[model samples]
Target: MERIVLPGDVVWEREVFASGTWVKDGITYAKVPGMLRDEKFIPLEMAYRPKVGDNVVGIVVDERNAGYMVDLNLPYNGVIPTRKVRISLRLGGMVYGKIAFVDEVGNVDIGEVDKLPAGKLITVPASKVPRIIGKKSSMLNQIRDISGSSVFVGNNGYIWIGQKGNMQLVMKALDLIIRRAHTTGLTDQVAKYLDENR
Candidate 1:
C-alpha cells in the first residue's frame, strides 16, 4: 500500500526498518514527507546519510597523516584510511568506494577505494538518485545506451560520466528524470526523449 506520509506518521507496525523512517520498538514511523511504496519510504527530498555498503563518488578535499578526507556530497566528510588504498591520493583527486562504517557521531569511514581519472562530475540531490537509477538499473542502462558512456552512480548523488558518451544527452536525461520522477510512465517518457533527441 502506497500513500503520502508525513513526519511522525506511523508507517508500519511490524519490526522493519527502511530509509526515511525511524523504528521504535516494533513500529516504523516516517521522518519526512515522502511516499511509502512496497514498505519502503522514499522521501521527496533528503540529504545523504552515510550507510554501510552505499557506493560513493567523492573528492579528496584534504589529507591527514593517516588518510584522506573525502567530500561525499553529504553534510559530513568521509575518511579514507591509507591502508585501504594501493596508491597515494592527491588533494584534489577523485575516489570511488563504498562506505565501510558510520560512527555514532556521524563520522564516515570509506573502504575498497579506487582512484578515478579526472572527468565530468555531476551532483544532484540524494533523494533523486533512486529515480535516476530506476528499478534494476533500467533508466541507468538506458542512459548508458543513449550516451555510450560507462556511467557510475553513487547513492550519495555524485554521477560520474565517462569520456566516450554523448555527455549533453546524458545530462539532459538526468534533468528529465529530476523533473518527471513522480509521474507515471517515466521510463517511457525517457525512452521517447532519448529517441527523439538522438
Candidate 2:
C-alpha cells in the first residue's frame, strides 16, 4: 500500500531527506498575461462579440463632448466617434452606424450608415419591420424623437434611420425601441401599464 503524498510532506530516499516544496494539490497553475489567478476564463459569446466586417447592434450609454459610450454587449464598452454621428440628433433620436474599428480592448466604433432613400441595405424581418415603424409612424416618431434620428420606412420593409448629431447614441436608442417593440404594444402599453400597475 502506498500513502498519498500531500503538500509539505517529506520523502526520505537513500538516507537523504528531501524537503518537500509546496505544490498545489492536483495540478500546477500557470499565469497568463492580462488574466487574474482566481478569475475564470469565459469565452465571449460569438453572437455578441464583434468581428471584423460583422454588423452589430448596440445602444448609447453615455454621451460626451468628445464621443459617446456604446453598449455593444461585449466585454468592453465601444466608443462612437463624433465624426460617425450626424450633427442633427436631438437629445432623443435614433441613429444607425457601421462598425469601423475594434480594438484589442474590445472597444468598437462605427461609421454612420447614412445615404437614406438609397433602399434597404439593413434589412430586418418583414413582420418586425412594422413594429419598428409602428402604427401610422407612431412608433417611428417616438424612435425619431428620442434617438434624434431620421427614420424612413419603405414599402419593401427597408428601414433607414440616420443620426442627427451623434448617430451612435440615436442608433442605440433605436435598437432598444425595436427590440422592445417585438413584445407588441410595448411602448404605449408600458407607460399605461405602469400607470395602472403602480
Cα lDDT computed for each candidate against the true fold: 0.86, 0.46
Q: Which ranges of candidate 1 are over 4 A from the true structure? A: 10-16, 23-28, 38-40
- Scanning candidate 1 in windows of ten residues, the lowest lDDT window is 39-48
Question: Over all chains combined, what TM-score does candidate 2 have?
Answer: 0.32
lDDT of 1 by residue, 64-102 (tens): 877899999887789998876656888988888999989
**TM-scores for every predicted model:** 0.86, 0.32
Please give, for residues 1-198, the per-residue lDDT of candidate 2 as tens digits.
Answer: 223233333322223312222224443232211111122221111123454554444455677876776544456756667765654333222335567777876667766633333212344433344455667867666656654556665322335555353345444544655556434356685334333422
CA RMSD of each candidate after superposition: 2.3, 17.9
Top-lDDT structure, candidate number: 1
